[model samples]
Target chain A: MYSKEHKDYLKKIKLHNLLVKISQIFILVFFLVIWQFLASTERINTFIFSSPFKVFETIISLYQNDDLIHHIWVTVYETLVGFGLGCLIGITIASILWANKFLFKVFDPYLTILNSLPKVALGPIIIIWGGANATSIIIMALLISVIITIISVHQGFTNTDENKIRLMKSLGANKWQIFSKLVFPSNIGTIMSAVKVNISMSLIGVIMGEFLTSKAGIGHLIMYGSQVFNLNLIITGVFILCIVASIMYYGVVLLEKKINSKWD
Target chain B: MSVLKIKDLRKTYHTKKDEILAVDNFSFELNEGEFVAIVGPSGCGKSTILQMICGLDKKSSGEIEVPLNIKIGFMPQGDSLFEWRNVLKNCLLGLELTNNVTKENKEYVLNLLKTYGLKDFIHAHPNNLSGGMRQRVSLIRTLATKPDILLLDEPFSALDYQSRLAVSDDVYKIIKKEKKSAIMVTHDISEAISMANKVIVLSNRPCTIKNIYNIELENKSTPINNRKDKKFAYYYDLIWKDIDYHV
Candidate 1:
């Protein structure tokens, strides 16, 4: 049961949400249509610019050759492996650093230097060390994502309420009890946000790794396409990458929602 | 009978530059079922004394004596409730930390919640509670540990004025009804006068006790009611002057 005004208000909110979704789809379709029209009519150079239809044809051709799924899977597998291991290593290192202030202080400058350095510059070393395979790609991804995760998660742990720590200490909580019951649980939101950032970083690192070395991922397809002057293949590779990245990012968002729901 | 005693307590905080003496020669006694308030100007070493007593902060030099069997509970300035936990779980946090979550302990906490009018919200999170309700829940959380002496550090300072008065009244009643000893630190002269059985006025930075007043209101009931007692104004004036108000 509801009042007339309340029903009207609910209707208005639903209408607004629908309009927003429609506008988003409209913008994407409009861009694709304009791009397709320009390329088909030769107003733009289709060979270089690569029309939407050409990209679609390229995707179909790759699917027919049974290369599309394999390429997408390779990139996704590398990203997930690197992301998962990166988060685990980051949390462990952060906990150790939090437990020993002297160790944290000793390594502070080194972490800062590593974080600020462009990780891509180390691609040659990583390829040499891990030997130019999926291993190298995953290693590169870990290098890119692990440092930032450690910094952010450790910051979150230290930023827990001082009074809460005092209360725990007054209650005769030992160090392990304080960390487990207070510090760790309170920083779940921080850790989740770090995960969100880590996924994107991992993707970037995987793509860069594939560009330098690897034969079977989307990044490798783009590299091969550019070297052979196949504009359609390059555009198709980028489109697939976009789809994969969005799916992975949304997956993390859903996980975060699930975790927060338990708290509230 | 005195349950706890402090003698010649001192604290010195060291920074990169120099050390600052926070509390010097601070000594006090808390009896079995007495409510004492320590009031002073802001930034005084009043809270430092409570911290030392509860073993949250180490004293540079001091003697704090209590029977080994006596347990102490602490309530910080804000409610300090873990928002991720529901009210009942929050109340159980101290017990959980101490690894004493027995069936009788759970039932005792439940009884406290029911007695304090929080039975309906036993499963609700802290954010869902009002300011007054949050303070009550915080007190019950302290009470849940079954401590003989409660150390309260500016417990109501986080609330707005309206809720501060009401929650202080509520907390005073709960403390009295539970028959537990308490030592509260605050900067409010009137709050000390109305609620405390004994008020210790502290001096500035290197805190020392200026004077201790044993309140004798005509009808010293709950805090709000005590404020209306004939002698409340007289004690308030005396303690107000005793504090070394820097500003």
Candidate 2:
């Protein structure tokens, strides 16, 4: 028997959810309208600020010229390759650290230092080591993402409940069994969190790498646009980067939701 | 025939601050299918005894004799159900760990879940289940290994009063119906007296067996029946007094 209050409560929840969705879209559009208005009114110099219309037209031109897809693809490919490798290497290293407490202890301080150190500062060194190519860009992204992934994922593996591990051990489960069965499954949320941060870190590294050397990609477009004072192209590049980042972040969110629904 | 035997078992923790002895010169025998409840004060190292029996903890000095190396299943406090695993998968954990997750074993576990009133919740995750149901799943996971003995550590403490009584009955019935020997460590005296065929009372820190009571009540089928058997209160009081709650 669903009472009136119960029915009302469920309806209220549905309404609240709808309201949240509408408000989120409203905020984005509101910001865009304000920006366009400011540029049109000349309150902000359209020459430098670049009106939304100019940005849109710039995007259309880039699309028509076929450079837009190429640039986006380049950045996306580099980021994806770097992100995948970084996560794989990072998780593998984290597993090694988790398996050997002594090694972890030896590397703990170094890991901490690496995690805190500004990775972009090593750009020149990386360029020297890997050469001024996609190699350096991918390495830069890996450096930015991998150390943080190691630290975060290792923390997750190590922070797995001691009680659960004991329970597994008491069952005569071996070290690998404990890792596969208990530690990894229990830390899915933590690992997903690391992945989210790792994505952003990798993006930052990719953009930074492109800023220094890349002849293609959204980052290069932004840099080149600024050199020639084509503010429209710069703003358009910024918009594209924002859209790409949002898609990737939302993709991770979708993955998290799928995993949680299936497993959690 | 006894499935487990422990004599002169001792465990001491040597730390920087001091040497702390947990279980001290403990000895016990668990015959096949004999339900033993180890009741003691909180922090009396009752769980330590179970851990030592399970070989998860090292003993300083002891003699442990198990004929043919009997399998032992340990269910720790807090359901400890993997939140990520659904009820059926959680139940299958032990079998999966032991590499015994065959078709027959899967069916057997699924049947066990069905018989234990978890038929409807097979696909539900641990978080979706009530405390009692999760505890039941934990117990089922332990039992799936087909161990000669079960070691449970205050599994029902997480449930409310009503659910605790109901689940204790359910667990007791399953244990008896399956002819399983169980050594459950709990601070609840009445729980020990009601569910156990024999109760071992342990003393405070540097814990050792203070007294052992062979519970006898005619027609005592389940823990719920044990409560109605008139002698429940007497055993509860006796063991309550035996536990040394002192510094």
Candidate 2 wrongly placed segments (more than 4 Å): A1-22, B120-128, B217-221
Query: Candidate 1, after superposition: displacement of residue B215 in Å?
Result: 0.7
Give model 2's DockQ, 2 decimals: 0.63
What lDDT would candidate 2 get against the real structure? 0.89
Residue A124 of model 1: what lDDT?
99
Q: Tens digit of lDDT per residue, candidate 2, span B3-48?
A: 9999999999899999999889899999999999998889888988
- Candidate 1 regions exceeding 4 Å error are none
Q: Lowest summed-lDDT stretch of 10 residues in model 2 chain B?
A: B217-226
In model 2, residue pairs whose N, Cα or C atoms come closer than 3 Å (at least 3 residues apart or on different chains), thus clashing, are none
- Native-structure RMSD, model 2: 2.6
* Top TM-score prediction, candidate number: 1
Model 2 lDDT tens row, A1-264: 999999999999999999999999999999899999999888999898998899999999999985799999989988988899999999999999999999999999999999899998999999888888888999999999999999999999999887788778877789999999899888889889999888888999999999888879988999999999999999999999999999998998898899877874
